[model samples]
Target: MAHDSRTPSVPPVRTQKLRAAVSSRLWPIPVFAVAAAVALGVVLPALDQAYDERFPEVLQVYLFSGGASAARSVLEAISGSLITVTSLTFSLTVVTLQLASSQFSPRLLRTFTSDRFVHWTLALFLGTFSYSLTVLRSVRSGTDGGTEFVPDIAVTVAFLLAIASVIGLVLFLAHLTREIRVETMMRNVHTETAATIERVLARKPSPDTDAAAAAGSLSGPEALAAPDGQPVEAATSGFLTLIDEPGLAAVARDAGAVVRINACMGDSVIAGVPFATVWAGAGRFTAAELEDLSRRIGGTVTVGFERTNDQDPAFGFRQLADVGARALSPGTNDPTTAVHVIGHLSSLLCDLVERDLGDRTVQDSDGSVRAVLAGPGFGHFLSTAVSQIRHYGMQDVQVALRLLALFEEVSWCDRSGAQRHVLQAGLAELREGIGQHHYTSAEKQTLMERYQRAQAAVTAQRGRPIY
Candidate 1:
């Protein structure tokens, strides 16, 4: 009959079987193992002796025989082996950790020393410990005089390997540190340039940002006539001057993305003519930021558009036209059209002196009295002659025209009467063309008066050639 039970019940047959198995093998198994080990140990030594006898020179022999010092010898050997192994393990662990953390390449590590050196060093330290242990054993057993032996060659070699590894790791770390500094500096420069350009385009110079840092001054508030007979918000026209001029070098360096040197004080820089090489340095700022730099630097500077590589619309020349356009006071005519016409006229007049000045070239390596002359018109003729006042607005423009004319008046001219007449004729032709169809009534009247005076001046200077 079978019975279902949750727990196991010991049966008579099972218990007897288990007892029989334990009694049969447990004691004999341990005894057999000990006997086998003893047999092997004894046989191995005898075999080694016989082999050495047959081939004495070829065999490397290590002997420990039963004697007064035999126990001490065995203990010393064990100690030495343990010490060498321990030293080797510790040295290897240290070197491996340093190599991984320091990021030194395998070849660089090779420049230190071979793995064999590490093993040798470890062996030496362990051998020293083993020698100490052996000496202690010898004293306890009363075998031989307690003496310790550690190989000097092994210990010295280990020390040298450790030193080399450390030096190599230090050098690698130093190189990485230097690389980080250079990269960081360049990044800062790039960021600054970009921010500068952005501020310029927005026409938003940060008084706050500027106040915090030491840089140039802010442009003064602009003034324009208002209907209330007071100054109101008006666009500044002409070559907007940069303040606290940092000179050309700063401009070229800080001008974001692309920078060019167009006009210098003496040399005429035209609106569109590109000059100088632009390269990456300062932060790649947007147009507004560059405008800020330009405002600080003082000059006819243009801040180009964001993302776009071409010149900005608010560029020097373009801004001048915009400002002039804004200043236009409309009568019964098309205000926008009038502004456009006036703006073009203003630009052309300003461009005249700039163009002529730009064209003049010095000749030769000797810096001799050679000159290349260019297009005509000094602001002087238009300023004093009434022609410019009718065509353009702004006191500044009138003043600039007068100064330009005065410069011409003071200069020496070599021209004959006939030559003067020919030049006057050319002037008349040019004036008529420039004043035709588009000029306001005031501009036309001014042109006529200026033409009459030009004829009279040539008549007076008949002997000199109009150059």
Candidate 2:
């Protein structure tokens, strides 16, 4: 295979997974904090010994004035108290996680876990405890064997760290309260999802500039493509959380074959299932070539136990939608929260309306199409956001009216009509749905008027881009 400096010969590092892991998991950041604190614990004691007599009188008073035994007592107290506080912090965190999981969507567990504030709070408490413990080892009494010595500066640092940990614990409680709110969760999801959209899609091509969407998405035979191509089976079963397309394309470009991924990002795949297929555009692949190609392709693919917001914008949609769905569930019956989710969904959809979306095609430096991967288009996103809510919330007039309003809100951003048509289809579904519900004549009439306004706007009004 021909390789160039511009092309990656191997799969790129899974930086996205690493990033997701560090953000959502509890240990990664705290481990660094503990290491730094432990080092500081060692270095500060040495400095205290070197500067014991050189310190100015004013500086000396500010440092620890306690004797060696007193210093040991203070250190022990700080360590013991901090370890207790750290345990309380974890308990609070676990309770928050449990409440969020049960009250909202289980998917929202990631939003809470990914909070840097909470992670830093845990880091601070743990760091203070570890620092105190490290410093305590340097505390010695004259009665024991050596001259009484107190690492004043090190004890002072541990004191400062304990104070910081106290503040962190207080702030973490406030932050947790805010995070558990539906509005905050939606905003976080919106911000993260918008960033994902920006990375995956630049801007919507003008109607004349890009008619690729005019044909809509791959359908029927095209959806199931790969006529004479060899199937590339998945190595494991899980959600397709991340894909390294450029690397896959680099491999495909080198092989002179085209790679077509069968599963979209976030789609669940079973092991041994054909998640992709490869067809030679130039020459037939030998059996040896096929085996080697599969190995190369597998490395660029990542399936996981759960979906992540790594490169998959749809994961964000799923989170927001899950929230709305849970809110509308009969057990919860929180129509107001469902309405808020609708607003968030509208924000995301409108923002995405300006971007080119559909099946993403990846090419090499030469502009040769090397990989064709299935993915969510605007329709998928719109449907993902609205469908479940409409199903669950149509009976609630507030949710229905808000959904109607969402169509009109999105109409302003539906400049290309790609999204409005989905909005239009959704409107039709909404109309049929509302008819089945038993509302007052006045309520139904109000709903129809709102629906008609949304319908006309969606059907006839070409939106101006709010970019």
Candidate 3:
């Protein structure tokens, strides 16, 4: 593809991923373990030398009397206790992963694995064990009738660490038990989804005459006809997780070209397919230059096998929706869990209704449109949150009733005209599904009454009948 001289100087997606991976919980255990071992190795020896060579004749009386044997005994005890605690921690983590996978969506395992508490707890236990063992080797026993060197300070510090490890173990147990609950999971997902929305939508440009004019010009025929531009094929096959907008805009602005994104976030793209098309503007570049630009553009877009919550709000919605669907499945048949999920979805939808969504158009400092990227619309999120549960739980009267109540509550919230229409359409679909399915007359009437209340709520908000 032709390189856009205008593309900004944004770091590639891989670089960003690398930075995040380095800071993840996966590294803390090993990093802390090494630090603890090295610190004790150096500090303990220095302290021993200081006490032996310098004064402190009064302190020598308080030093351990059993010589090397006492130091060895303390070291053995600390190692044994830490090993057991570490084993217990691993066992609990594995059990929790299994339960979260079976009870909720398997995707939630990532959240558990990345938990900082789990990482720090394991790090402390292993770190303490390593420190004690290193110090154990330094304990020296003098010959018979000679002075006995005990490394008293090292043993004292090791004992304190052992005490801390025990406290950590107790806290880990309490935390693990609470982390596996459904309410906690729902709340965490909700918070993440909200944060993603705020982060992504905060960049949206306010309406401006110049920006609108630029948007219009970019959509014109001449701009669309990029005979000079080349097709930039995807390097790998995976879901497009994130796109660096500012970087792409800078590239386009610098290259004096326009870039159009073909794949939206959360979309799975195949290798060798055109993920984006770049058209060279007034400047002309050679094939080699174009290739380099293609590589740079590819770097800005990330493709991964699985969808992540980092940039895709839809994934969060999918997770919450999946929980509700699974609960309503025949094997589980837990409507109460599904109902709780619906309440969460209602709150999320309410927040989204007040926000603007669509193609994210990035403008240059001069108010010219440089890049346009695709994002999920409000309707897309609504369908993702409601469609699956509506289909799977249609036969159950309680599920249907609660679904309608969700719609009613959301409709009552202050929302734009378009958002209200989406809610009305959801209500209509539910009423149609209930009508098509076999329901007792009383059951059907009960559902219809709830649907009417939802419809009334919207109509009252709009000052006219929505249906």
Candidate 4:
């Protein structure tokens, strides 16, 4: 019944762009490392010959005049050692890849293994080809053979650089992957905390807007307007106002409290809907108290002008007397009183019910009856009864009788602590008005009979001990 309507403000486009920029900065390290690896391994090979031709004299010292024999033996030994080392390194890398894949994902392992099978098979083929090249160069340059067809120094340097680059890329990728995993974990924690707060707020009493109110103020979204060209509020400390049809307000006050429980300020309270306004300080107490206050008021439509969210200590709710004084001030003659709004709404709802039920004389075919108790018929009758009961020191009797009558007609009523306390307080006031324990003999006898009859009926219904 109470709308906790708050608009959800859209996040700024600039904020999204900033977030994207930060993410790009964090994730680009892997890309740069891969690019460097490509340059060192693939690009350097094409530039080798130019650097080699420029260093021909250096090559001559290592290759000419019987020094070629020693160079040949050393080249054979170095090439053989490199082949063994690269093979061992590749095998270890494959083992590491399998272990990592199994730890994280089996499907990933299957894909990686399938793709790398061709790479490993091709590398093996190239190793054999390079070995054959080495043997051909040795054969062509043996003894009196010329340096015209020999392998250049650039080829050896390029091959070593390529292997080292591949190793570096693999290490860099591992570091980037760990960083991404950590970032993901932190994001999930923040999301879960936000969701938990939402779930807890959804179950309590107060306007559903209370959740949004928990976030910010109602003014940020669809703010309610007060009548008489002034702000209608309960208390300035930390309250706002909601105005709606009088009829709708009464139903929410009496039967729709549950609906409002989900609403908070900064929440969605639709227009043309009736609601109660309540004031709260900062935390759960204000929210809990508002629920208690609404229950005490019974069937009246109430505008709970209260803080939608947590409030500052200096600006929270003050006493009602203070509020009334503010209302009486010359600058603001706001006729929109909280009590008036509630009373007006209550009257409207009662009028609607009277119209629906018709006069007391109208009876249903099943012997069930509805009495319109607002206007001329039972309305005047009950008003007179209230006076008579008050004059005779029988307020408890009047209240009990009215309650029984309501129970017979209505299917249910809220039995919240605040509502029951208000009813009991009303009975006490009536007793005080007529002087307690001052009933006449005949009145006492009548009261005793009514009590006995009511007890018997209750026992029959419950089919158990009254206690």
Identify the candidate with maximal lDDT. 2
C-alpha lDDT (0 to 100) for residue 177 of candidate 1: 45
Which digits, one per residue and each the tens of the lDDT, describe model 4 over residues 41-101?
A: 3433344334536656756565223344544554465456545654554565466456434
Name the 10 consecutive residues with the lowest summed lDDT in model 1. 217-226
Candidate 3 backbone overlaps, count: 14
Using Cα atoms with residue i matched to residue i, what is each candidate's TM-score against the true structure? 0.19, 0.91, 0.85, 0.21
Pairing residues by index, what is the TM-score of model 3? 0.85
* lDDT winner, 1 or 2: 2
Task: Please write out the lDDT profile of model 1 over residues 1-467, one tens digit for every residue.
Answer: 11111111223333433443333222333344345434433444345434534644422232332443444454455455554555445655455535422431222222123233333334334433433442332233332564332222222222343344344335434533442332222232223323322422222124564252212111110111112111111123232222112233334333422233333221233333332223333334355654454444334233211111011112222222322333333422223332333333333333232121222221222222111122123333233223332344322323223322322232213132323443444455445544444555775566455455544544555332133
Error of 2 at 291 (Å): 2.4
lDDT of 2 at 168: 83
Q: What lDDT, from 0 to 1, does candidate 4 have?
A: 0.32
Q: Give all candidates' CA lDDT scores.
A: 0.33, 0.81, 0.76, 0.32
Cα-based RMSD of the predictions, in order?
A: 36.5, 4.5, 4.6, 29.2
Put down candidate 2 lDDT per residue, 1-467, tens digits, no spaces.
22222222333447666788799899888889899889988998888888889999988888989888789988999999999998998998899899889988898888888899988898898888898999898888888687787999999888888888888888888988898777888899899998777766657565553454333322112322446888888888999988877678778877878888988888999988788989886456888998899889988888888888776789898999999999889898899999999998898888888776666666555445567777677778888988999998999999999998888889877876767667778889988989989999899999998988887778774753222
TM-score of candidate 2 against the unseen true structure: 0.91
RMSD of 4: 29.2
Residue 53 displacement (Å), model 4: 9.0
Q: Candidate 4: lDDT of 19? A: 38
Off by over 4 Å in 4: 1-66, 110-141, 144-150, 154-467
Whole-structure CA lDDT of model 1: 0.33
